[model samples]
Target: MAEEETELSDEQKKEIAKWFLLNAPAGEIQYVAKDLKSVLNADDVYNEAASEAFPVYNKSHMICLGMSGHFGDVLVTSYGELNENEYLDPKTAQVAIVDHVKQVCTEVRPATDEELPSPYIEEYRCALEAEMLKYVSEAYPKGVCSVYCINGKDAEGPGSDFELVVVISAARLSPQNFCNGSWRSIWNIEFKDDIQSLELKGKLQVGAHYFEEGNVQLDTKHECRDSTIFQSPDDSAIAIASVIRHHETEYLASLEESYLNLPDTTFKDLRRKLPVTRTLFPWHNTSQFSLTREISKELGIGK
Candidate 1:
């Protein structure tokens, strides 16, 4: 008779998962027959593992899973990475696993050179970043310089370690008064291998309106459009410009739709006419629309 195989408990499974995530060699693809729920239950473990294994501050290590029944050597099909937030999402993990199993496992063979992580990824990232920066500078003369990409905590607390930022601003007067207008957009660019994750965050103000619509949040329409994926940093920078230009057009449309024929329109009325919806920040009573516009225009974004 054949000997019975021992079954692993949830704890044991997590332990095994943590071990592989923590110690797996960079660019190596290791196979585990059982489906361990480690990726789901262990947030701290993933954070720790990524902290140790992340190729760079802007890039995350990739994780792939195999199905339970297969027994051949796991062959890595591609090389890529995700942001920490993207990596930790259970749905993303599941998709990667299922995709991997579907793409390979029918034959036994070593991963090809193309499937392996780049040997000089650090230098590669630096070169890519330089090219991206140059592109931003040349393509967007109005794009403001910022230190938001710095790698460490700020005086307030932890800060985003984004690789680059493109701040774009646009404003127009009431066609009569200099004190009336709207618009600002900022894109945080996190560079990955052959891809750039662009996050949109900014503020919108209307003529003499007290409330300001700002930041991408769950309840906002812009939230869904917040994170855009691009093939290159140059394309991502162009996207930033495109978003600002769209805002300019939207602002004009809002003026025509909401302000025309209506006298002394309130902020709420103007916002209702805008194309995009966003959370209105009303925390402080002193926050004025005219004031916000002045500050934004004078200092500009990324200052």
Candidate 2:
């Protein structure tokens, strides 16, 4: 039955490819065919099948499969290598980054008079409050035009470290000016040193922040921080965008050199070499439930 289903899917894919070839522009037929080939060549369907068949597959396999499938082995390989060299492999560096972020992000618990208190919850709350206060003070000394903080867990899901989101209202900050200069300058200043200076015992990962402009007018001195997490709150989007754009351009210029260094192979071979799994959705896997529960416990929440 499974074999029949697989055959049917392949047939359907072929039919779709034929339809695309006939309907698409004559000049674009090759491109469409290439895309179809890539999709059919993907290893995700096989990995998914294997995962469904074997419930005991480990987390590393799942993560590798999912990330490698979705992002491609080249991207995963590059990112993994970069992560190892830049943050993971070096114990000292990894510790420094994690510790730095934790230190800067950690907060002393505020005293409370409530009876039957939960110390864990209190500590977590204090840490969050401190992080919020610190960022607000550093970025908006006068007071935030707006503030949005959502409590969540890290990318690895519930048992992972806290994911604290702090979105400061940039209504009062001049979007144009920030889009022009301040954002870029700040990112360049903090990007490397801050992460390098940290002394902790874990990997440090950062994501970029996005900006949305509305009706509020921003002051000239402030702007929305650029998307990079490692960038300082004072960094402006305009400068960072320009810098990133330039960097990409430069990177592309060296693609030929990079490509020459890689081995020539078909997409299918690459896909098989790197299976796919859903690593980003950690909650989807039941195996990690215990870890999640532990995280909740740490946060002083009911298991």
Candidate 3:
């Protein structure tokens, strides 16, 4: 990455500058600085707005606007950094910053196919999945796991990153309480090799439903008790555990505020917390894609 930095040419800088200028507001002076740090992609327009001692509107503010789309009203404010000297009034800063940004802005298009998948990302996903699968099979003899190659299109839109959903089934455990208790014991069997190095992804809800004779609904969390890893590899245990831990940590961190508000809680609340449907499963992705395509077709944007 460092070596690649030296190869960036004056033409590339001018191109970035052009993008900045086009996206700038109707009136602004565009100042092109060579050593600006990009907040997103390395090759994308860089931001030099922070380099000055005091906030002065510059070409970098235009770059920021171009990176963040112009459809919605955007307000940029400077909050006091660790140092107290960096404070700026939010309202005044918002207007001045936006005006400055508009003055030096340029239009930028979404990334093309050539820039979508970097070599490192493609290799990382492939290698990670393979290693996860092998680890699961070797460690958990009674459990089963499988991996599927997922295209970004069937879930989110084209610009979305590739996603992996893993499902695991253990014969000795029930699915309802599977994630709740003794997760470490289960993971011990699932990931016996280099567990720390593995980049666990996310947890998923996997289950099925049934109807009774009179059409009464039966809610069974572990409807499939066959002890088969139907969708993903057992190594997904790591990812699921990680997500659960994160959620717990976040919940605990907010406990003080939650406790303070508990006394005011009312019965029969209208607000919803979790989504009604299980969003982690493949079926949700299919439904979402179908709905999206239908909407796009209605809008005459379907390909």
Candidate 4:
């Protein structure tokens, strides 16, 4: 079912306009106007603004004037990332914002040969020479950085003694052009023969929804799997298990805090806490890609 839109109040407009005026990128600031309405989209924009520091690009860009084409109240959309300053006409504001996005797109580029084989990749290559060198020489996986490539790394983990090293390779792509959200550009570690060295058959992908939104500060606690780390044939199991621990911790915490201030906290509630059944032994799938499926689906990447 579609939810009804709630209109913003006068106080809300004042707060929003205040924010827009303050963060308008040094010279982008124009004269502040009186009547701007704030549009809400579920919880992606406003609630996120209250809790997190998101990038400017993640905010809304489309500027819609209410038919008459004159500014009643100057507009403020998004959370100051892409703004239509009150000083310009609606059409001019939209054009200026589009150009701003174009400026941002120019900065994102595929890693070059000198850029590939990152420090982590170099570290892995130093560990095993024959497998890595042989794979690179034969595969020649060179196009876009993520295309025709291998990535390997010793994932520094918490708790366990397993020194897990993972490698992933995708050889069937050309150019594979990635935008801001594409896994190729977002992940900090990009390796060149890490996958080919391990001889794994799994497909590798680095797509993300947040990647396109361009917010680097959002918490990845909801991410069930780290794609590059999880696709490693050798280390995926241990890496996923580690992720499960974090997931379950967050899950349990959420469960405990829910339904606060309920009036039923009496002797009956105490009785509910008593155990009536034997402890159920737990079992886990220990799967990597299984956890990442949702992330991939949301990002429109295939299995």
Candidate number with greatest TM-score: 1
Residue-level lDDT tens digits of model 3 in 16-38: 55554443221123322322233
Worst 10 residues of 3 by lDDT: 180-189
Query: Tens digit of lDDT per residue, candidate 1, span 179-248?
Result: 3222233444444433445554544322232213432211111221345564433454556556544654
Candidate 3: global Cα-lDDT? 0.32
Off-target runs (Cα >4 Å) in candidate 2 are 1-122, 145-162, 173-303
Pairs with steric clashes in candidate 4: 56-81, 150-193, 150-194, 167-195, 168-195, 181-211, 183-206
| Best of the two (1, 3) by lDDT | 1
Which TM-score value belongs to model 4? 0.22
Model 3 residue 156 CA deviation (Å) reads 18
What is candidate 2's lDDT per residue for 1-303, written digit by digit as tens?
345444557445555545544432212233444565576674454334322222211111111111111221111111112222111111011111111111111111222222111333223333433444455456543322111112221122222222222222211223333221111111111222324221111111111222346322211221222233322223322233344344433543454454464453544455443435524545567768887888989999963
Worst 10 residues of 2 by lDDT: 89-98
Residues 6-70, candidate 4: write the lDDT tens digits: 87764564456547644432112221111112333334334334322122322221122221223
**Candidate 4, lDDT over the whole model:** 0.31
TM-scores of the candidates are 0.26, 0.17, 0.19, 0.22
What lDDT is reached at residue 276 by model 1? 47
Of the two candidates 3 and 4, the one with more favorable lDDT, higher being better, is 3
lDDT of 3 at 248: 32
Q: What is the lDDT, from 0 to 100, of the residue 216 in candidate 4?
A: 33
